[model samples]
Target chain A: MSTTRRVVIEPLTRVEGHGKVTIRLDSAGEVESARLHVVEFRGFERFIQGRPYWEMPVAVQRLCGICPVSHHLAAAKAMDGIVGVDELTPTAEKVRRLMHYGQIFQSHALHFFHLSSPDLLFGFDSDPATRNVIGVAGAFPELARQGILMRKYGQEVIQATAGKKVHGTGAIPGGVNRSLTSAERVELAADIPRQKRWAAEAVAIARDYTLENLAFATEFAAFPSNHLGLVRPDGTFDLYDGVLRAVDESGEKILNDVEAGRYADVLVEEVRPWSYMKFPFLRELGPHKGWYRVGPLARLAVCERIATPEAEAARVQFDEAMGGRPGTMSLAYHWARMIETLSAIEEIEQLLDDPDIEGDDLVRKGERRPESVGVIEAPRGTLFHHYVVADDDTVMRANLIVSTTSNNEPMNRAVESVAKKFLTGTEITEGLLNHVEVAIRAYDPCLSCATHALGKMPLVIEIQDAGGRTLAEGKRNS
Target chain B: MSESFTFYIDGVPVEAAPGMTILDAAQAAGIWIPRLCWHEELEPFGGCRVCTVKMNGRSCAACTQPAEPESVVENDSVALREWRKALVELLFAEGNHFCMACEKSGSCELQALAYRLGIAAPRFEHRWQAREVDASHADVLIDRNRCILCARCVRASRDLDGKNVFGFTGRGPERRVAVNSDARLRDTDLDVSDRAVDICPVGAIIRKGVGFTVPIGARRYDGAPIGSDVESANDELESANEHTEGGAAATVRQEE
Candidate 1:
């Protein structure tokens, strides 16, 4: 007699966009393989066709409301190539970089303090009813308020610099439209010290909780995987502008200082029948060995130093405490996220102090070209917006490789690793299932940005027998 | 004429001055009647029919109808709101009104009306009509896809600027706004400072030098819905005038 089973976690909660987890169990009730499936698709690429290249920046920003700046800047950078502007003016460069930093801070604050902290502080097995940001607010009101305020400050910067927090139209091809005003500068700078303090406290909290769980840190959702990020030519962390960098699991550099536009030469996307999300891998290593992670943890692992002084100090401590090599633990992503937030705040302060940030020469004009590519480090990971335009400058083809899609293969691996370690029997418990979610959450995947879904995410989990009969199920929201 | 004529919209009584259209009188009474092609500065065109209201049990275009004495006007009924929403959806489906990409997004009256009506998705199938963008002008671009045939530009050119540089061509689905010259905008007398350039109710007419000068969040319609002040009598003109024509895209930045 043979026995087989399957487990599914549908509409995973506390994450952007829709997703499901499926685990196959062998006849002996042992784990076979697990997969994280992205279920929704918005054909942004197909619809973006025929739009003028000048419109790409504004249009692509609508891909995800949460990370519109990432898309906005990336598309603008690609548009820079189309207009034949190899480098932006010094003022334009600073303004765009400031906008990018603001986005990273807000998005990371949202994920860490609001989404991930509930599980880290309350324990994953805690009641699903009280295990959310509301629960966090009930327990630690000040922390919750700080998180909201931090996010607000970031939004205010985006509004001042780019135009709006959600889909600001400040960025354009070649350069930005306007520079920061003195009044706006002073207003944003006034809150800088307070924001830096909050970021520091958040980082301290992440360090403590993440360091406490060594076994889970090293094992759960943690596996040997390649890492990808962007770094300045001098080997420092850069979120807004830099060359592509890739490293293997051992922290050895595989590719360094590669132009972001040439991403196709180094990375290739693999499509699986089961999901709309494409798994991107390194061209030389193939899918299995090429699977790598991109984001906070990967960024921390790939960069030698962070530019900001305070964030650099935090990085040193994180490296010393979380094992010297970059890929020591997976949960360290939380710590990296906090550090990145701190760096973003510090960068904001730095940009404000510089007099060139108010320069009136905001735009640069150049000869038009037929095709170009834009790449930037989104809060999640590296984002690419490629466009081919006609002589009339209308878009002919568009290809986008978002951060979450690039991490699809490794996200699946993390889910599989967690399932195999925690789930053993035919029957599944809530605690074990939460472990799977925790593993996935460690990466802070934004499925909404990944698949470009248009609806709110409602998470669900189900366990079934080999015959596809439902045996057990759990749901958060329909 | 001494006694103001009274009308009720959504059961609220409103007074109208003599010779005032129902739409204009409704604005004076702080009642919002959704409209297109009815700029306060320009003569009413009533081409789009977005401000359709039921007057004494019969449908009428509010912008073109004079407010009569003791008139019962129904403007905010559920059926009318749905009708306006459907019309906006049809206009959206009929054109490539990609709000995400359009330079006139926040300030676009059509997009603002759609947002005001809470239109998440259109009920009609998108025609994906192929349209032409004439960028031959030294400083103006005419993208026909975003036009809703409001004719504000043509009137502005003829009456305000006296350039007579714009006209309508074709009919029905094939009908479109066109430059007066056979060649392009460059051949016509239209300049960056022309009244016709900034009077467009949609992204159809935009200045070349400025695409995103005001940024998305700080644009005229970002915070308040279109005509929020005119209909509400709140006077948001102070904030609205700060960024109206200073930026690159010198299109319609004020509510008409």
Candidate 2:
């Protein structure tokens, strides 16, 4: 008789939201298949229905604490369309851009220094008790301090532009509500040199770590997939606002320069039975072959060049390190994320120098539209917010595709790749499970944003044979 | 003209005209007694009870109670403070006051009053009851979810605008601001310029398209607590009175 067994890793850690991995093995103890299950559901899209259209920008910020600014800006952009304002005043646009860059810089800094550094500094198989930000601080005190300060500087920038740190009312429909005062500009500019230096140092650290672990990093959950992001009309990197672009594994444009409003025409979301998250794929390529990757790795692959000098140079070095090919390594996400952080700092410096950011002409309005879409490159991936407003000014319908939701398929693929490569026996060991978590962390998935759910679930792992008798079990809450 | 009388509130003598309510007398003397349903331009309804004070050891709504000669009234006692705080808390629990996203967050009288009362969160169980929103009006929106049954709009429309566009419909917890028309603010003759449109102490009645226009920090009560203007005015008046009294006493001594 053929015998099969299953291993379940419940409540995956070191990532945002609640998720679990189930690995099934064949009769010979060979890994058969793996699936990542998102256990929570919020129905946030349904909750926003019937609310006033103007409230969307602030209301949607409740989606995720880690990326509230992303939702705020995305919903604001969509509402900008509802009010019929195609082009914002220079001051308004620059202020919004400054807020976006601050968000990306701070979010990246937090993920690297607080969340992912533990794995890189201590090996994946290291003891769980000593593999966290606290451990990193204890050993690498100066680096850890730099991380905290960098995150703080970025948050200060956000506070100045967005009004407060959380659920800011800065980006309103039509245009931004306020602009940076001269004093605010001066204060933020004072630390630009220091921020730039730290950002560059971060890039070097990620680059060195990836290059040194070339053999393991290259094949860890690595696969060929399409990349997607937003780019300026001139094909340079743009995070806040731009036309949508997608490139295949070989760096060939599959969808080029599509307006955000026309995204539904080229991309469609597919629902699977096992997970609450939706899988978005390119329409022309079909779901089977159209699953793509997003976020820092994808942005680095899709953009032609970085606009900032220091980041542009780092991008060149990255491309050379990859042998002038499209980067498919999941571990390289850390390196790509640091490069974007440097680019955001450089952009912040330029914005502070421009006097337009302090101008009083902050809002403009035109003919109103009934339907609109807003797309932005959130730190994790491309985020989409679409809304239909009724004549009474209430939202008729709302559909949000958060960054983590866009990376659902890729995350599953990553987990499967790691599980197949690491599982050696019926017993699920801690070090082996960490390998699976490390792959998922590379994507920086925000399950809360994806599922729109509240609260956390305790971690539990169980291994069972075909008869359902438990062979091994482990549990954790932190 | 009738003769005025004097009364002591919290040990401070306040002068009042014949037929003036305690709240009116306090306001005329530049003292803020914190009333919600009593607008200077409209008649006092005394519905909110946020201005309840002890008059001669009896609890009375300051906005409606007549000022009596030599009457002792306690306005800011510990018991009164706790009573007022509980009233405010009940008001918060009775409505879906989502202050975080409310357009009137910084300027709402209810929110400002809560801040002044030092009530961070409501103690009562929140009644998340379903409320109707009337957005059919071209220039006005009535989001009843935020209504505290203040009756400011009801009086403003009936007494000030002479349109009588608003009135109350239900009793107790069911009470809500209702338009004169069968349904919706648009069906009524209420105009965007009517006093009723701006009379709502909360966000229940708002002019459409004007919400959240003023940045947060620049809103009405962002810099100071709700009745600080009245308190500061009282301070200036008392100082001027002291100076005048000192000069008059010096003159009398020289004449003697």
Candidate 3:
């Protein structure tokens, strides 16, 4: 027996930005099939079609202030193809690659340590008032400070290149709008080794967390018949561009080198009646048999190696989680994120050391051309932007594949697995659902980018007692 | 693509770059086309429509029309007056174009454009759209009716800002900027430096801070509609010994 309960989330106040999560467990004491409902979509995909081709980098970068550099780079890649001006000065590309790495450092730190770490380490049920970084700050201020400095390093790289953070206006199609100074590169090089040590220590802390015995299936791997690669001979780690590959549990390649524009062929979105998000799968394998995951865990399995020394050491430990061949394990995603964080930092440093980055004429003014797709392996997953332009260089059409859309299926599957394991017969604790939500947040789905929206932050979860009296409820305003 | 053509502006004949917009050409020639909706950082949107100049016999928005041969653009002059006048009229009558009620009153683009054009009153009948002020956002607010369908804010959200936080819904005068996710901007991943606020031609879009700091004077489009009318109102400050033609010419300077 279930009674109707209307719980209104009044603008979830003071959180990340905008979002709420709502969960309804039937009277039968089971998730009547959970729904990850995203009530908001910013409509970025729809309106961006008519935008001037030249301004794509600055325009799309504003989609989310948090990861402006990534969006800026992706849009630049798409615009680069539209303009057909590929005299990409080595220094420009290097600075771009470096700025991108800085973004990875900051964003990964934010998502893993700040957003997802609290739930995993402190346990999600640890007092709402005490559940924040400040709550953790009293105990783990060093960790928090490390995350902030790492993020600042990335922001500084962007500032050095473009001018400021947020809407830095750094990456431009054909090349970057601004160039970096040799002095900036020197500073970046000096900072990387220090960051590398911090990442090393962070990885140590992450590796120590044993997520086993959490009641979830530690052995069940989703469509593990594919190894993934993002812009490399094999998926080792290529940030700017890559084709997504899926391998099976036994570690055999099912999908290899494929173009990103045709990514829709492999990722078929499944729209659950309950979720605003559509699940993605390997289309060639068929949905009935296709299940794949992207982002850090998926990336670790797809790539053959991590290019940086500090990260490679951590990769070995991360690789060990997948039985040495990059298998599918939900908890292993956290470990992979830390290792990639190290790789991302080292890669940025290497890019900074390049000498050709100081030239001012990096971008060709008023140059635009045909259709092209900018493909990159976002720290979350494979990201692709396909832009079709007119002969006059006006953008006619655009199709974007965001990290959230790629991970939607795996996220749901993981959530279901976790829910069935823990919440099947229990007190319907908030901590259990928080864990499940963190699993989805681990992918750091840019729903704002996926839907091409103005903004969206939907995390609506409702709770009530056995007699239908309100016990406690929490809403996601951020 | 149209064949390349040549055009003249301000007495100089120039070759029009193939497939170039008028704004692009003007920019290439080091000519500054004073604009609100057209930003280098954002996708070109002819929302404010203030950049309209006489090309052929007819006036067209500089941002929307292509730059081609056999076309002439007059940024300032009698021809520019008619366009600016009409442009001000539309901005005045549309939504709640109440210059007096706004804090961005004097410095408002619509008001400044009007003073430049010498609009005695909004000649057109006002079709005041019932609008609301959404103060939900921490930094900014959306004044619905004051907005002229110029998509500067939307462009800023998508192009320069990358927030994709605000957009236009419906079509024509029924058009309005809606926050993404249909929630107040406070609910979205948005900030005040949003280009939307930057491009608002009227008092419709104003930043939370710096409201009413400057006083407004003159009537509609005379001394100053944009907050501090220092540039346009300088003549009035020294009207006693000032050249009588000076005030009129200054208005003409802004008109073109």
Judging by lDDT, tell me the better candidate of 1 and 3. 1
Clashes of 3: 68
Q: Comparing to the true complex, what docking class would candidate 3 get?
A: incorrect
lDDT of each: 0.83, 0.86, 0.63
TM-score of 1: 0.83
Q: After superposition, how far is residue B212 of candidate 3 from its true place, in Å?
A: 33
Number of the top-ranking candidate, with TM-score as the measure:
2
**Candidate 1 lDDT by residue in tens digits, B110-176:** 8777777767666899999888888666567788888888889999999999999999899899998
Top lDDT: which candidate number?
A: 2
Name the better of 2 and 3 by DockQ: 2
Candidate 3 chain A: 10-residue stretch with minimal lDDT: A6-15
Clashing pairs in 2: none
Which 10 consecutive residues of model 2 chain B have the lowest summed lDDT?
B247-256
**Candidate 2 Cα misplacement greater than 4 A, ranges:** A1-3, A26-28, A456-458, A465-472, B236-256
RMSD for each model, in Å, please?
A: 6.1, 6.6, 16.0
Question: What lDDT is reached at residue B91 by model 2?
Answer: 88
lDDT of 1 at A31: 88
Query: lDDT per residue, candidate 1, A1-478, as tens digits?
Result: 3457788888787777789998888877788989999899998899877666778788888888788999999999999998889988989999999999999989999989888888998898898778889999999899999999999999888887787677878888889987899999999999988999999999999988877886668887777778899999888999987889988877899887798889989999998899989989999898878878899988988999998899999999988875677664667889989999999999999999998899988778888888898999999998988999875556889899999998898788888988898886636777778888887787888887788766556667776777888777778762
Per-residue alpha-carbon lDDT of candidate 3 for residues B1-256, written as tens digits (9 for 90 to 100): 6566778775556566677788777666544454556766666767677788778767778887888776777765665657667866876787776443354544566655555456666689888676655656656666675777667777777877777877877777677778887657678887676565666666665665333223122223435323233323333333431332335534653432
List runs of model 1 lying over 4 Å from the truth. B1-35, B38-46, B49-100, B111-144, B152-199, B207-209, B216-256
In candidate 2, what are the lDDT values of residues B1-256, reduced to their tens digit?
A: 9889999888889999888999988887876787778788888788889899999999999999999999999987778878988998898898998887788887888887877766766699999988988889888888999998888888888888998998889888898889998888889999999998898888988887665667767787767667666766788654543432223323332221
